[model samples]
Target: MAIEGPFWRAIAVFRVASLVYATVLMAQYRGYEQPMLGWLVIGVMALWTAGATFAYSVRALRRWPLPAIDLLTALACLLASPYVQGAGQGAAGTLPVPATWVAAPVLAWAVYGGRRAGTAAGIVVAAGDLWLRIREPDVPIMINGAVLLVMAGVVVGHVARLAKQAEARMQRAFEMEAAQRERERLARDIHDGVLQVLALVQRRGRRLGGEAAELGRLAGEQEAALRELVSGTAPQPEGATDLRTLLTRHGSPDVTISTPATPLVLPTETARSLAAAVGAALDNVRAHCGPGARAWVLAESGDGTVTVSVRDDGPGIPDGRLEEAAGDGRMGVARSIRGRVAELGGEVSIVSVHGQGTEIEITLPA
Candidate 1:
């Protein structure tokens, strides 16, 4: 059964109201006794009972448990009330001991919630009645009440633990929702602000002359990096891609970025991811093989797939070395290239021979 917090709140309210009723009855009965003394003691007990009720109402606001106060109040009544009983049972009738009425709310606070709160209150009640134990050594009534109160406290403590666990779970749920929204927002900004600027620069580069054309070329590389990020195709950024453009400018002054001679259609998303992957692969050629490293960019389309290969005449990756490089957080080859390719239902295989060179193969479903 789903236990709504309001249900516990209603139970707390009822327990308090019952205590208030018991208080009023005790006060009315004591009005016929030594008016002043009787009224004063009743008022003190009533105040304590009211205090316990107020604690439950705002218990959640407190960082620590507060229902302990209710238990303390009960113990006070058990001890004090017995002492205030009839001084002479000879000619006069027995004076009423209103301890149980005070004890009732304390018990409820302990039991309703769980054992800890209940046991604490029960100890006070039992200890408070210790005077009776001294007077009648044969009767162990005080110890009996104490044992019962302890049992109640144990139950209340367990219940409070459950309530606290529920509160923690509720707080964590709110935090996760807030975090997910933040990730979505960051993705949008990279697409609109960074990616858009890079795209503009790439478009203007082909027409510009001299250094202006070089500036546009750098922008084109950034566009590819941003494109991968916006799509979440690559978890890592292609940082060394800037070097790829420097190599291209030096190696071939009239760099012709050729598209297929025949019209080949690809998913807009697939093309964007492929561009980012190719951009990272080119970066590896420049950084490791050096700017003088001769490289070829080839794209072939057929069989509902497209493959882009970057082959470089630089020292190739050692056998089983690509995994070691990726493990170090240099995700240029892993996150930026393989990650993007994998997202597009693609395959990547790197063939490198010592002293020969390296060839990176990437094939993606169109």
Candidate 2:
């Protein structure tokens, strides 16, 4: 069975205990004759006692705010029961009725609201009853009930504070687990799908004739864009891949791009991807063309198409070698750049002589 919280459990204990206390006090006094008004009052008090307990039973199943309601009910019962005892009329034999239990409301409020408010609640309740002077004119009521109520309030308030802290920690742990799952999902998508396709295009585009060239170009562009996105530094969309802009960033300080005076507006996704592809090729130049190799970026815009060429003063690739490498499933040229261009309905071609140097001439339908 699910456990009831201290608040509701405490209320149940109080209800049964208070009911016993009230019944005992009533049984001890018999001299007061039953008056019609006294019976009516007793009936009402009985209703409150039973009603408060019923409320406690439901609280374990739902948050019923039982404390606030129970406090009012208990007060009403105490108020009605004292009149039924007929002690306010100064009945001497009945040991004088004292409605001091009215202050029990402070205990109810404290456990519900917590320690920070419990002290103030106890003060207000004690003061309210003192202000009213709940004793019959000549009677001295027991102070023990008030002291017990105050203690209950303090203990329950402290317990509630600890419960609230435990709930907060549990919520934070669930959130951390959810966040880690999302990160794993992102890493998997990048590794298996996007990166693999780009690698294939970049390698194949290097050697194969015709559309194989185009496939290689598209792959290269996607790989660059993906890398940037993963790093949280994807390029801002201005237009399609700006070959000149990308080349300038990766190109040597001496390397320059020749372009139209008006900047072309390319699709930003296309532009960044393409630029990244060219940048990858430039990286190749720097790595393979020797430290002394110089490079340039050239671009042209027309007919909804764009072309970017990265040329280097470096030793050129041998003709049969690139195809041989692809046959073995090596992906450097096939997937790195050409695949992306092919996806974009364009082609990539590389021209080179073993001694004359190399040029990566890539054309994409704008």
Candidate 3:
């Protein structure tokens, strides 16, 4: 059951207990301006107690009208106490006819509308109790009941508000757990079924040489895309993008991407700039080598820095090739990859050894 169930039940129990206490007090003290009229008021209190308990127990009935009526009822009973016990009785330290029974509405308001509502209800009842002092002449004012009423309203209301917040947090936690479980189950199913078929097609296409090989390559790309989708990378918040999500999009049969298992959250513009730089490197591999040449993209984040490395299995760039290209106005390497990284307060390092392929590593402050 929800946390609120126990609160309502407790309120119901308190109402019943307070009602019994009031009945005993009224019976014990027979002195009154009108004894029969006082019992009539007690009868009204009994009926209202039963009605309030019923109303509060129903979820739909715990609204403005009910709580409003509840406070008004309690105030009526409290004010009636003066007439029932006579003005001098309360001034002489005798308990009111309703006694502590009037605090029920305060607790109800606290539970219904939190601390402020509870406190307001307490003040209303306390004011009515204090007003009784006006009826008594030349007697020391008793404010203990008023003080206790206000305190109960404030404390109980605060507790009820905290309980509501705790309940909300618990609900969100349960929803996230259930979603994770479902995602894991789906990932397992895809790994066992579709992933195996895609892997087989990729292997067979690689063994065969022509159009079938191309078809197999496409299948491999689809397989890679599927793997990333089920990798349990949740969507990032607005204005923020996970670098892995953008980097993984570049994954293919010929191109592989490796990123941290956890999210690499960055500003949307930063992640996009990084991913675009990586894409340029891959474009270089396809332009320099054949389409069949493979590449790997590695993304790492640590020590307040983010690094991405794009390495391609292609004939390495000849010595001074980038400088030569920049001199010739062929700025693919200088402009596309290097310039983008440099603008973002980062440095790019290109390593190429004749037969060992080329690697471009970009590092940025996180």
Candidate 4:
């Protein structure tokens, strides 16, 4: 759309130049038998050129009527060529009334209606010019002029169309980026306040027992569901988000997270999901290994892949414990940790010893 400004300005400049060229040609030829008529037509062309230049500068005025009037006026000038120059003057090398000034209308049509309108305007103006010069010996020159007019129209129209399409795509991308930012902001707000409160209620209710415990369990379930919703793995917008920036938020005194000083960039959704999976692993440590248990999260990148390890210095899982939990319909590790990583074309491996500790490693293509 910004290109329209420069295009119209160029059209204005072209009109002024063509007007001067037509004036010089007419003065040199001195072929007008009707002097007053010749001067009157020139006056009309000059006034119209000024008016069109001003009208096109204002976007609202650049519509059908302006270009239509412009084409008709140019055609009228071409038709009046013989009368103004006298019967045999056109054959004696007299110029058409508007001369090169006719290109103004052709360009206007091209800008407004693209290739089709441009070609149509060119054909109509060229037809009128040729009709007036039908008996001239230099008929080939008129034919060549017509061809040039058509080509100019097509080229200008094509450029205008491409500019419009590019502008549209830019607008859509801007809007989508704005929406993505808003979604992330809302997700952050929910994660910071609502999810934390729900998780606390669930944990406390189980300790209190009775109906309070039941309420806490319900809240905990809702919290897990909400966390999933907030950290949804929807396809990201083009480009990468810094994974280190996202994971840094999880650092605490009891749980230490170590990452490379350099930025770790991945698709926006992938980074969010990976961070959520890490959070889920930390949640498991706090729930099963006591809140005071120490945990370390380490991130490493190499060989076109990234690996994150979450290890806890707490009693390790007993053999078949995970299977027993799954049989009882508890899917904390199954869905929250492994499921999230697997969706990103990654693999999750669990290593645990009866007394020493437990470690979970997630490896994904970079």
lDDT of 1 by residue, 76-176 (tens): 55455444543321113322344345446444555455565556566666665555556644443335555665665566557766766687777666765
Report the lDDT tens digits of candidate 3 across residue range 1-366: 267778888988888888888778667765677677678878888899899988888888877999899888888877777666664465454776677778988998988888898888998888888888756767677788889988998999999889999988888778778887887888998899998999999889988958788778778878877887777667576799999988888887789899988889988998899899998998899789775898999999999999999999899999888889999999988888988999899999999988889999999998
Would you list the C-alpha lDDT of every candidate in the order shown? 0.58, 0.61, 0.85, 0.82
lDDT of 2 by residue, 216-306 (tens): 6556656655654444322334345444445445433335566665565567776677777787778777668764467788888777777
Question: How does each model score on TM-score?
Answer: 0.44, 0.43, 0.68, 0.56
Tell me which of candidates 1 and 3 scores higher on lDDT.
Answer: 3
Candidate 4 lDDT by residue in tens digits, 1-366: 666888889999999999988888777766578767877888888999999999999999888999999999888877777778885455545567778998889999998888889888888887777676675655444577888888889888888878888888888878767777877888988878998898789778878877786577568656655664566433334678777766666665466779897767798889899999999998898789974578899998999998999999999999999999999999999999889999999999999998877999999899
RMSD of each: 13.1, 16.9, 5.9, 8.8
Cα TM-score of candidate 1: 0.44
Best by lDDT: 3
Please report, as a residue range, the 10-residue window in candidate 4 with the lowest summed lDDT.
Answer: 228-237
Q: Which stretches of candidate 1 lie over 4 Å from their true place?
A: 1-15, 18-39, 51-71, 86-124, 129-135, 140-148, 181-193, 196-366
lDDT at 12, model 1: 54
> What's the C-alpha lDDT at position 210 in model 2?
60
Quote the positional error of residue 255 for candidate 3 in Å. Answer: 3.5
Candidate 3 lDDT score at position 179 = 80
What are the runs in model 4 whose C-alpha is more than 4 Å off?
A: 135-141, 198-366
